[model samples]
Target: MFSHHGHGHGQYQPPATGPQHEPTFKIFCRADEGYCLTVRHDAVHWYKDMRHSTRVKDEEGHPAFALVNRATGLAVKHSLGQSHPVKLVPYNPEYQDESVLWTESKDVGHGFRCIRMVNNIYLNLDAFHGDKSHGGVHDGTTVVLWEWCKGDNQCWKILPWGPEAYAPPPPPAYGHQAYPPPPPNREPGHGYHPAPAFYPPQPPPSHDEPGYGYHPPPGGPPGAGYGNRLPRALASEPTVRILCRADEAYSLTVRNGAVCLAPTNPRDDFQHWVKDMRHSTSIKDEEGYPAFALVNKATGEAIKHSLGQSHPVRLVPYNPEYLDESVLWTESKDVGHGFRCVRMVNNIYLNFDAFHGDKDHGGVHDGTTVVLWEWCKGDNQRWKILPWFCFWRDEYCSGLILYYSTMRCSRPLPPALLPPPLPLPPLAAKAVEVVPKRSERIAAKMALEALEGPIHAVSRAQRNLMRKLGLVPERGPVTAEAIAAYNALFSKPLSQEHIIALSSLFSGSLPPGKAAEALVVCG
Candidate 1:
């Protein structure tokens, strides 16, 4: 039989037999500091100082415990499947539900332990499609069961539950000593005084004080530096370059007004693109994917899709509003290894056609033209988005050191040493009012049919509505097979009243007659 240990000793022992009678504890995932595992709205989430009970073990003789949230009184449950997410359910006092059981392993370091399910999958902080720049731990990130790979995101710390868990740790002792021997005395009525040359000298006055806070340097903003200025200056709008996944050495570059794949070069500004934050915010698509323009550093031109398959991408003058759809693209689908499919209008994607010549045998090489192509899930379609400085590390390391040094010193460089300021993009224009025309809509439908093959005109509207409701694939043509799949998913179709109610909720002003037509088509 196993024994239990008290709090603060960082030791927890589960009961070897019989029902659990141990004290409750807080569970904290090592992936995010200071946040503990909690149940919110029937879902396992990360929050501050939530308590859980882990005394009960599985009746089937497997070494596991039922994690029940103290606040919600719900037990954490993970279905015996890979696709299901971990959730919180009403506690069963009899302990009959086996899915509520979990097994905690030995400490993995820093008092964090891996909690595994009976299916051999571990409770993990979901970061499957996380951004590479950050660790990907954010507010409300879901908890899921994933195959164990020994990652810190899968390790959790068990802490004693109580008011003591919420108490802050004692601050470090500095001992008896005046902090900086007091700042040197200055002349009367003089508010500013120079600090000493030693490390971490007296800090400047706060922004509220007269003559303090961050003031723009003579040449540019606070963070801007000379020499290698692009990366440091545009910190708000990060500088990133697109690298072809099929050929890692080749990057998307603008050469002679056309987009092409060329060998990665640090000095070549054509390969560097700034992800336009302003346009991304204003011109996002209906699906919530941010459609941003990739602006080339050297030419100040944006990569524009010319519309239609096999059409060469061109570098056009930047349009802040993204009034033209050709200049907008979205990175919605992750394709592994920090790469994603850069999707354009409809189902077209940015592709490096390595098989352009000799369709059966051509291979990816330098100078290959980048063009628009229908989605085929090929490696040539995946592109890695990386910071421009990452590609020019060898050349900009010294500039980075100088930048950090200035940041530490808290002194602005002399005006003579500063580089010329870069021009900022014009503010986005007011959104253009769109007047829908039947002729234009028909033309667009015809274009889509040419690319993806034709669908029946009779049920087109119903199929499109079902696609929006996630009953069918959004990009493909509505075929008989697709209709059958939709029917299989929904055995009982909604009535005319239900369709009208849904339409009113979504569009608020959709006519009832149109909603009734939708129901008939759905039937």
Candidate 2:
């Protein structure tokens, strides 16, 4: 057995002495917390979850070895196509991707061991404790990265849970193959007839609201789109840096006559670019492929890569004439993180290439230049156009209050928050008391359980029937109380104004004051 040492976490390398077998051992941190390092089903990254007993094992209760890759000597990784902190996952026989290799390190220090993955990144939880920063203290929170220093959450113990405790592996297929040959198709116009294609049944409509039954078009508040994009959708959403393929946050700003890309701060205002499709130079590109301006909210300018000019692209005031072919840029394909912004004038793509003192007056040494170059699928060539939702940028309100007032009632709550609707029959709508109060109470319970449509409609039907019999109430409070009073007269309907008081009585929309009366008729 050989061991390699002295390297830091991100720079450590396993000794290249052919393939190595990582002994099967259960990992533990705080035994009392009962969390062991467990792998996701995808076999990418290991998280702080899984009990100590639930590790990889074979039949006959024997532990399984973590086969380290001969080339890299690292274990499972979370990030495949993207760059991220390396983490561990269980080894999968099929699809054996790049991260199926790992090596157990000798006690690094502080009487603890480390599990290093293929990319030389150690399985580190020193920076975080699976706490609120990562959705509160629980199992399966992200195991982060750090330089190798065994202390606190970074230190771990590999306790051997004997083979006797290992669970037996499931039996593998012996005779049947997964991809069996398809059934032979019959010749057209032959003696055989083909069967119709079978489709699965669909689920029932959602019934989380009053009018969500199989009738009345399942009424409730209109869809969010009905609000005229009041806290608008993603296209009208807030602007973000949209970190590029290079993993570097690029700041978009104009200095010395051209737009430049520099390293950005956390929330850099200079990097915020709004994609405005309202004005397009060509009518041909209006449909899905609309030409637009990358408007900077901070400076109130647009990126102008002057057509045919050798000079770097500069940010200038939006001119309706110049917006013809020069300023408008078309969005190409989505490049994973962002889109490729192609200059409409010359058909060339915009890029943030390193400025090596090109003698352009608008160039910066450390910063990147906005040059119009051929698209090569490079990281710097992609630009993310973030959306802005605040009223300062556009005249749109958050509509947060409106949403809560309208939809909050629909959610489930404790019994105290929503009292049962009062019991009252349509006959009670008149001053004459014929039905006994006990019978009305039993009828009310049944009515409440059955009614499932708009309260206003049910109320109207009741009032119309009462009017025909000439049994309308005299003046104030009908049926002795406010609920019955409101129920007697369907003509008086509750509006949005009564939401606050009604919000306490029901879970869906503000139930009409006479909603209880409507239920009796509906039942």
Candidate 3:
């Protein structure tokens, strides 16, 4: 049975889970607050998406992991400590599907963008299609946007100990296959299609903002950082480097007359640096080539920079508490990554009693940068933190106002240090399309239920009408499926009243069939 010790890949090994003390290493610490946690890892390095570090998605759009609750910030803890095995919380139904990257071409499911990459290099931008050929699929194969980036599929970091040293956790449903095979009968097309007249799906709207089809983002407030996004780079990029060779132009030596010293120092030749897959902290790939400068020091939020306007600043080492990893979720939810220790007039933290101004008055916009600083504890000093909605808890704001706000709203608050509760405009200009609201869903459900009776009646009427028209199916005792076929084939006027009238009109018919397959639409 082994035990956890030391740090990094070498020293961080957990016990066999039989009976051992697993060395505990802090993957992340939100100053003092904490929340949902997984088995800790000893070497989990996160990189920004644009940095071309993780192939999964740009760090801007997709974060490696996230923490919520009393601690509110966006930054990934790149584990450099040792490994320790830990048991996964059984049936963690609370598991959230965070966005790993942005869909340059299309959306996956929910609001998650669909795409793939190899290493940290860009490859193909595509949408996930179940079976049909929407873009350029063949064999009815489903295709999602995929770039040839490395480590894209390496979703989890596995760490197991001897018998008990629980540290780095295992994936859900441990000791079993995570992804089961598709149903045997289900064909692999754009999406599983039972029969004709049914296509898999349409590209989901990029942003769920009312009716604004699908905008690729940069479509919102300036600084609400969108982490881990994978956008394509323009072509015609140079592939060359200059080498320094202490050369004394040989061609000019003879013409000079005077004895000129020929180039004698050994020369160094520079070659084109190409992007490659290399695990690292802050910077995505450090082995082959780096999109941004490498981390001189990999401290917890000590390394990296945000890619500002040009490329934002290099991603500072992320601290999940301050920033979000998912680009779509962050943008939709409106958040940023990394927190700078702000200097203050009082030159201190944890002393909010004297806190006057705002905690984080300066907004954390899409490309905003924050370094630790000091400020007076007032509206100017108090900053609105996120994921944590406590008035002063850990500064995690989710659109809810503080308990003492004059407006007095008890829901989630958004954007820190708001002077007053001003109604924020809709996220989109046109109309932000969203899933049917609760009330709309309820209404739709009622409408669906109401259709049941009429549908039954309509089936009977249809059978009678078919008999009158002499086009009824040979099968007796018509089934709902059969009725559906009939309805679809005939295209009669469809309304609840019409269906009931038809049913009553043909009540004397032979066998009464059912209506269309039970539609389970909420609305």
Candidate 1 per-residue lDDT, tens place, 156-191, comes to 776655645333433324773211211345221121
Model 1, runs deviating above 4 Å: 1-236, 345-360, 390-523
lDDT of 3 at 447: 10
State the weakest 10-residue window (summed lDDT) of model 3: 248-257
Per-candidate TM equals 0.31, 0.26, 0.15
Stretches of candidate 3 off by over 4 Å are: 1-101, 106-121, 124-309, 314-523
lDDT of candidate 2 over 61-122, digit per residue (tens): 22223432211223334222111234433333332122233334556565565544322233
Compute the lDDT of residue 284 as modeled in candidate 2. Answer: 24
Task: Give the Å shift of residue 326 in candidate 2.
Answer: 1.2
- Displacement of residue 124 (Cα, Å) in model 2 is 60
**Top of the candidates by TM-score:** 1
Estimate the lDDT of model 1.
Answer: 0.47
Cα-lDDT of candidate 3: 0.22
Better model by lDDT, 2 or 3? 2
How much is 518 displaced in model 2, in angstroms? 40
What's the count of clashing pairs in each model shown? Answer: 0, 13, 154
